[model samples]
Target: MSAYGFEIVQTLIVDTEPDEYVKRAMSKINAAESNYLAGLVVGLRDSVLAFSMNVPGTTSKDFLGMVLVTQYFVTMKEIGALSESNPVFITHGPGTVKDIASQIRDGLLQVNTTQN
Candidate 1:
């Protein structure tokens, strides 16, 4: 039988620290949303990477990659204030707010970057 199409995947930093890592993840997601960043939940294994706003073909995809990395850095800088019981955190869904945060921290962090 002929071989099937190979799945090409984008690589991301799989964080597994605990609590702190969670904050970092949420912070990035939050910053992305705050910046009015546009993109779908491409993947949610470790660290998240939202697609960039521009649609410049492959270049645009690369930009989305940049956004993901940049957001991670931004979050790391402010991880000190992140806590584990932030009310803003969500409690359901695959990429639910809480899951995203804690997943990075290896199921320790529990904060939500969303406001409201």
Candidate 2:
């Protein structure tokens, strides 16, 4: 992973209340095309975290990040289902797009050193 490079495996747009719109969105993303290591955007009432979990067929090849949108909380079970990578959680204010660009930059640097 280079300093300016990051990969996005999967993306989940969740809602805290799990309403019709949120549910529909989740279903669509889940059914849509995704990468081997999926990234998740978990939303709470006041904050959101861009996260990735460890699942099957994924290894510590590199680190990446993404910005999560929407408003809703996610269950532990749901989080577990989609992630199979090192969990990266960064929380920020609601409705604000906190870019995980820096996180990915730092994380990859760390991974490179540790793996090497």
Q: Which stretches of candidate 2 lie over 4 Å from their true place?
A: 1-99
Q: Score residue 64 of candidate 2 by CA lDDT.
A: 22
Q: Note the Cα lDDT for every prediction shown.
A: 0.51, 0.47
Model 1: per-residue lDDT, tens digit, 22-94? 8899999999896663333334312232333233344643554455455555655456367763444324443
Instruction: Count backbone overlaps in model 1.
Output: 2
For residue 6, model 1's alpha carbon misses the true position, in angstroms, by 63
RMSD (Cα, Å) for all candidates, in order, is 23.7, 22.0
Q: Report how far off residue 116 is in candidate 2 (Å).
A: 2.8
TM-score for each of the candidates: 0.22, 0.20
* Model 2 lDDT per residue over 7-102, tens place: 766668554577899899988787663532233322331122222243443333322222223221343336657767567564655433334444
Give the per-residue Cα lDDT of candidate 2 at 35.
Answer: 33
